[model samples]
Target: MSNAPSSPTGPVNRLAETTSPYLRQHAHNPVDWWPWCEEALALARETDRPILLSIGYSACHWCHVMAHESFEDPGTAELMNRLFVNIKVDREERPDLDKIYQTAHQLLAQRPGGWPLTVFLMPDDQKPFFAGTYFPREPRHGLPAFKQLMQGVERAYREQKTAIESQNESLMAALAELEPHASDALPERSAIDAALQQLDTSFDPEHGGFGDAPKFPHPTNLDLLLRHATDAPQTGAPDRSALAKAVWTLERMVRGGLTDQLGGGFYRYSVDALWMIPHFEKMLYDNGPLLALCCDAFAVTEDPVFRDAAVMTADWVLREMQSPEGGYWSSLDADSEGEEGKFYVWDREEIRALLAPAEYAPFAAVYRLDRPANCEGRWHLHGYRTPEAVAVDLGLEPARVQALLAAARATLYVARERRVRPGRDEKVLTAWNALMIKGLARAARTFDRPDYLESAEQALAFIRGTLWREGRLLATYKDGTAHLNAYLDDYANLLDALLELLQTRWSRADLDFALALAEVLLDQFEDPIGGGFWFTGRDHETLIHRTKPLGDEAIPSGNGVAALALERLGHLVGEPRYLAAAERTLKLAAESIRRMPYAHATLLFALDEWLDPPETLVIRAGDERLDAWRREAQRGYRPRRFVLGIPADESHLPGTLAAMAPGERPRIYRCSGTRCEPPTESLADVVKPTS
Candidate 1:
């Protein structure tokens, strides 16, 4: 009867001493677990036991499943305790550790899987030899049981340790070769053309998204495609029809169930290719990029659908996700009431009961709820009538029908809120909040909504005051305390947010802070030898390998954001070093960029910088008319454009850029390099090319 919850069948260990919710959840497990630290590694080295590393986030469904089925089971845990130095890591707090190990798993599995990542490593050096995801308690689903797998791995480590170590060494060597490189042989322009053509062919013209089942937002890719559609090429012939189709597809996404009709934000992704029947989880990162994309789409088409979707997403973040202190929450779980889509799915009878008899039929018809349920014996609501369809159904004008739907949807949202909502993971991640802040700030300026700007400012203040210490940012904050060293994403995204805020509000402090953080990012995260940025800061816990992640994931790659940050810093601070760093990173990642341009959206933006440098628009005065012109310019689909708003009364610009003359009339100066265009007073003239 040890206090460690040993079932008389398993060994006892020190993970029982910690209070990290993730660790505490495993404290009573029969497995002897060790919290990651120098002590754990030393124990592994001393015992000659291969370290069994289990990494996952608290809200991950599969993580919970593994804990229940294996970690908590006395028999399975006993075998694990006897064989390995079990270590648990919360990937949310230590994304650096997760990145390296997850990359190793990807190499081993040859395909990606998520949650409860189990990696087995050598004792002394912590070099991973084997990696896989969750395993069941007993053999099921054609997969080996946890006990059998652990015994096999333990036997291999004990009997064939040398061979296992040699294999791991080879794996690491192969992983090192995965880095992207700039090659003279790469057909860069042609690759981009091919990617665009592939997109055109792959595009679901009948619907709005790309490819087949399990459609993702891929907002970055869509944004890039939209740019190609709108911006007339400097050399090649313009494809106006392709641009129109792109715009049409984007509009469809806005109107489809991919967008939350009753709620204001998007679900993680659509399970189907038609942008209907979304997976129930809602991630902060997905919403951020989607919000920005929606804002841009609204700017191009001035389509009300795009505008409403953007506003709704911003509103959702502000209402549901925003922390009391101002930063946004991480995500909403996919499951509630013991089922994945329970909170979101509805029964036909339940819908009928909730609405008046007459109202129910019309509402059901409007939402396409009269059809057989999409989910097994349940209706997963989707695909509300289009404007034309709604017009026909309501026997009214299209505009009037749209207005009515909007008003009715607001009422339904309130009713939906009354139901049991999915649990929110309220940990405020600095990188994600930074992305959302930038998205909201950009949306605010584009939509002329001061509230969105205010939300962004408040979140920035919270991050600066609460999550920042001694000029360095903390990665996560919860319950009034910040923990974990800030990653490169935090610095890069925060810098991007500051730049966006500067454009929105012309805040000098924001500009100065952004410049300083950009410098810190270069100094701390930059790989001077490798020519890219590492995810972990220089002072954070060192791993067996430092990975420079450039591949796109749920969020844009840190390297992509870092490149964008460096380019913006260069433009803002008038320093070639920042630009040079960005160029080097892009060059280093050129091979991957050329091969998978769709995956490297932010990098494409960086490439656009080299191909056609961002136009610096300096406005010396702030008149409402001038603000409108500046906002319009920002709203337009100009990927290679930067705006610096300097009030005429300010003594100097923060960067090396020169200040404009003080004058009564507001002026716009468009500069590319050392040369500046003649100052123009006409708003129409400034916005003419934007249309």
Candidate 2:
């Protein structure tokens, strides 16, 4: 699967010179595609033609469908080239444009928007007047044909210019209205309770997810749930009831088709509520958060299932996603061999011949192979029954059944490897790699896996070495080029990841990297007047609109993560400026958080820390108990706690960490908010609340 369009004989367009794999995927399209650059925008204005902008990522299935059905067709491509300046953008590479246009599409269509997003913009202002997604080559499914739609759009642009201009005015106003307005105070704890209540209302008791069919992993929501469950009563035990919903959901996901049974990563999402059929694309962003969530879930419940899921996911990333250059790749495409799920689905005879009767019987019984085909008339593996249940049916021991299934899976995986693999988008994205680094570091600390920590450090080193330059960061890198001004997510996420990595293994260089990112975030991305962070940097290219978003989407909110990271770093280094910035961000989003707290899970996380600042534990020890002390302090899940253990001989520490010099014996300094308890050797006293 080259991911090239069907029209392969045409001369390459401007996309041929770009680094984005998504844009390059359309290089051979008959549609004279132009990369979204100043040159393309200028050409549209010079010709006085509308700009047809299509935004999507490499792994999106419908993006491929639209490209194949319309962009590849000669007649359709000719119309697109003649009528408008066809500009293509990879959403991953240029999320600022995608965010603005997607919001416009939602407002225009009165529904949610998705890729491949189609918009017609006035070239002079670049304001979209018409928008849609995935129109067919010929009229079907209530959508007008792409050719007819373009002609109509062109006629409107020429004849009804005034009406379009009027609509654009209203659209711009609506987009501005969507930005959060600053409030005087921080959000109250009632908002957190309300969010949990809301989750409970929408939670599917039968299926263990939030909503009906087409369930996403929603890692942020799960993380909030897990933290809520474990934030105990200082001395008493935690409320175990809150853990049930998140644990139930996580267990079902691990056993479902959403997880790769033979492989070791999760697909994009499940197409059904039962989690039995997935969309079948693996993304680094999704897995990173999910990996950390699994580790936390294991810590809270001591469940082996979560630990296993974390191990498998980490192994998959190490084996498949990590590049030789040390940065993690963005995503794996959903389609292979020109068809969806062609690489993962299996026929009945293929499985029967691969395994012995004992292995085949247990595998078939547990993985729904004995039942009718579940996906595209072939089996996509899902845990139809537990091994214990399958063992009873097969008249075998549970341990023996597990051994047989493991052997069967190994054989099947080897056979599957011989097939053509899906196309991998090899571009290294800073925001996404930071997310994976955070997950890997958390997993390493929780599971005591040095290898995981090393992998995380390598990715961080790649970013520091390649992306970070001259007190700033680059958004993405591929081949030998790293360009595009870094966005808020890049700076905020990497800073947060650096904090996590420091907890695993403190590095002076990493600490310096974290401090630099924090400074860049406050200097370049923060909206001083408005009191929150903008999605784009100050030096970013001018666009139709500049956005400051507070809600969580596919990933955590950048503003939310920024506030959290800045606040944590402030406590660590005694920087009141960083602390003040975080406080202002919370106040800025106060009203929005109250109105829709569920959508602002990341912000709620920051708010939780704000309402009651985290307990900071500084350990200065010379003995081997340093590792043991750190681990024991973090034994149970405490979301409002930070622990850092420095060696006895380490020197030149910053802020409060520097003041706490090593004593004759192991000593701990506990700080809550502005107050600090005297140095104590007892771990129990440090773990308890200071009165």
Candidate 3:
């Protein structure tokens, strides 16, 4: 069985005994790959053959161009090692084997395919029929060549094996059916006014993102269009607004090129639809939900351009994806030198050979770069020019032409940090470091920034001293170990980043490690008789489908953000079993939120907190004037609400909270459920009842 010459020539069996550096970067390829378990599906059902698989990740740039053109050639690894039984997996460590091979390559490429996918299957039980992605080892770009598409899928699995298993069992039974709903359920304010009339029929109001040309930043459909424009006049629908088209598509995606205006996050999408060019991968879960949608558009329009794009995406996640044992590094590479927007496109004569020619036409007319048509001819993006078009081309004073294009974009972000950058993927993960510790502790209480709350307490002390362990919660670290198996979106996004760092550092050991990892995510990813939350973990090693992770793809649904972090840790600790496991995981996706309510906008922000449950702002005494009155009560636009800060020797305040006793220099305690109020020691008495 050792065959020894299984292609890319030698070593790497059992993915060199795992711990995935993308399955040890296909440990010496030569095609006899394997690594997707059950002993590679019992050696492809004992050599009846046809498995193949593939999938990808490890900062996928065409999964390193189909692993350096045809899994490192050697005659396309001896015709994929004498026809199929390959395997390989790593879609970020089995996102349920990349959701059943990307739903069988969108039902065999009916359209929709990405990554280095590939596919094929059949080995008696593995299933899939055929899929596709990168091909070309000879036949030019129009596709079809990996050795005549592996000798015509090994002569149609040895002469049309039952018409390719009856066309992949009728396309996996028409993709496991499921749609049919309408027995009239609506009311949740007519299913949020038919999801704001399907976001005003996929709003793109002349370029600001919704649909049209590859754009992405859905940020949970701009957080369900700012919670249905602040819950539409208490549901009577006063002038149906979708929060001014979700703040003009988040201020034109922070002035386009899908944001990265000289570094400071964003860009996992925007292949043109006015967000201009992009596809330059940045990720860490798209800068923790675009820095919590630029701190909820700077708390509903205090918009200093969404507070300087949420303080330059929390200072580019503390200067380039944090982690010096602080945690946060998952992605960056959208190819660096090997092309793809090579260190972020430039051209216009390399900004006229780095400025001077009298500051290259006012830094190329304040960034829209005078001419070179969008990308390809270079100058990818830089739109919102006005500061009176950089004060009529830098004669100055539109706030000094916006402080000289912010000091020439800080000297071209220090000469694009001396070039060759990209390639980060250091991999920490635990659900993208609990979504950048709840977007750097909610952008350090809105934005006062004690260095974004000490970079969210050194990423919650490097996810409680290196990805916790033994008592579980590991999910992925890298180099210094902490291998896989953690999913359920890494314990519901690290217990909602330790309940938003115990609501701004109240830290009774970060609310006892977010109530002991929310009872280890209700004893390992719940779903008792199917409710929700099962991206694997009922004693691990189980497959052939246990999935359950609701919807929302590019982030959201670790069972809809663990049912809104168990309804805000069951109102911060008065746990009714964390609000009955967030009402039985939103009644098992109440019919996939009435058939795709914009792919469950964070389960409609936890079903608008089980239908209206916000308003809880208890701040006791953690000082810096109760941290500047809890950063001016999180700068407004409440969205229901919950803001506990308790710290004068903490004594109970989490059984659905309601206790506040400090008042000599640090106070403020507003509540909702278990009601309570009166206790304010200024920050203008806690913004005099919500301003």
Candidate 4:
């Protein structure tokens, strides 16, 4: 298959008009790329040629490599353009296509799937019969050259038409088997215990994460652990061991290279088991849940580490990622100037020259300057020793040592600003932006940072002003173009974010926004005949298949978030229909919940709430201070506790809490499903749980 290929060249393509930054990145490729649309598919069917579907996002490193190698090479591009209808898709913009093809890829390759996914689909129904990731421009590393592979695939399709159709028929059957489990019973609360037991099998006790090398921080699983840890003492739950795991993982991640110590964000994941080497992409989606997790960890453990991490990550979002208007951008790429980690790594001599001798001593010892470089012969600044250890080694006060390192880190950060930076995908995605707003709102309330809340409000206002048009939501916005129909995740996640935002500080407009989104979720996305919601809206363009997403992958499952938001909004608005929808969705996934608890962590959270409905605490403003009482009430990790405060001058009461009207004095009312205990003025009594 090794053959001498023609030189690489460039030509503009139809992708120039695409809204996605990912697609635009390939506008000048030699491959004659066509945006994923009817025209491209129509041509393939008319010519009886196969479709080459290349799917990836903007921040993907290997996606860029493949484009440069095969898509840019004249010979490979010529072969691709001649043999198939070349379609380029931004996975972020078309997750429905990505999800369907990714499953097919796994089935065909019998391996896990990832970015730069290359799939060859039948022209008739867009059903994929062959799949792979990142083909070399020429033969290398035991993989066939791109041109050779294309030739082989084309020849096989032409010569073995009968066998190919037979195989696709079997493949179609395999795809159908991936559907959700059908069950007659709701998942029992005992499944939470089962999940924790299964999670323990992969839990790395010493390192504080799941499994081995190429570790990903599964925020969903960590969230389940945090909630379980918080309720263990009160409910006698067996997942008390979750606390140690959560704390250990958070601490290790913060100390390792996975976190951008100089810049104030986290890389996507670690390339090694110890979290020492990271993939270097900074994603807004990953940071959002991670920040929320850090805040919850701080609340549960009172660990200064978690608090510091939350502050740093939030600061990074505001500093580097916020758009010119107010929305948060999607991601920052892992590479700069054709080299991965170039923007982040530091030279030892450069560090020494940038810092004072006194500053360098402690910083060097703490950050492992004495050890071999981890990335391309340059240090990535992962601290090897704790501040206390450094203080002891330096024979100095811990506080003094901390001051020195902080000063040194500041200097290093300034010097790094002079380097060429990784590309930023400035597209503001509705679902991703909502995650950040929710994270910021949580941080604002938990850490008492009004600035954080202000940031959230700014982003929320931007979304409302620009993305919402004519009573419908748009998914991605970049350079004043917002076209794609918003999906279930956009509405579901935004509803969840708004609910969290409302808790921090009540605003009727935001509340109305939440209500409107819920209406859309039920109307446009929900399965009226079955249960759960589809990934695309009813108004969305008809595709080969409409998917009802149920598990967490890359982000929280749309179905899980929809169920969660419905439950919360239902109770807060006194809407029975919303609650019923939530219950129906949960019932649909009951069997899957019992079997794979960790994979379906977010759904399990919703399931947990269903098992035990939460109590609503409405505090009426009087002349008394709210510090001690509020602290005691929120000290434990009570995921089921709902608290709201209203001033005495307030008048409008929503249908959800009409029972707790404002009064002359500051008082607290605890209500559960229309029943309320007498109002209490005493803080100590209010702090006591049902126990």
Candidate that would win on lDDT: 2
Name the lDDT value of residue 400 in candidate 3.
61
Candidate 2 lDDT, 365-441, residue by residue in tens: 88878688999799999997888999998889988998998899899999999999998999999999999999999
RMSD for each of the candidates = 3.8, 1.9, 21.2, 3.5
- Give the range where candidate 4 is weakest over 10 consecutive residues by summed lDDT: 1-10
Local accuracy of candidate 3 as per-residue lDDT tens digits, 527-577: 655566677888887554455757788888787788787877776555777
With candidate 2 superimposed using the best TM-score fit, by how many Å does residue 622's alpha carbon deviate from the native? 3.3
lDDT tens string, model 4, 622-691? 4445434554566545567777665565667667566666565578888664456888876565567633
Question: How do all models score by TM-score?
Answer: 0.92, 0.97, 0.36, 0.95
Is 2 or 3 the stronger prediction by TM-score?
A: 2
Report every candidate's CA lDDT: 0.76, 0.89, 0.73, 0.84
Question: Using alpha carbons, what is the TM-score of model 4?
Answer: 0.95
Write the number of the candidate with greater lDDT, choosing between 1 and 3. Answer: 1
* Alpha carbon lDDT at 239, candidate 4: 54
Top TM-score hit: 2
Worst 10 residues of 3 by lDDT: 178-187
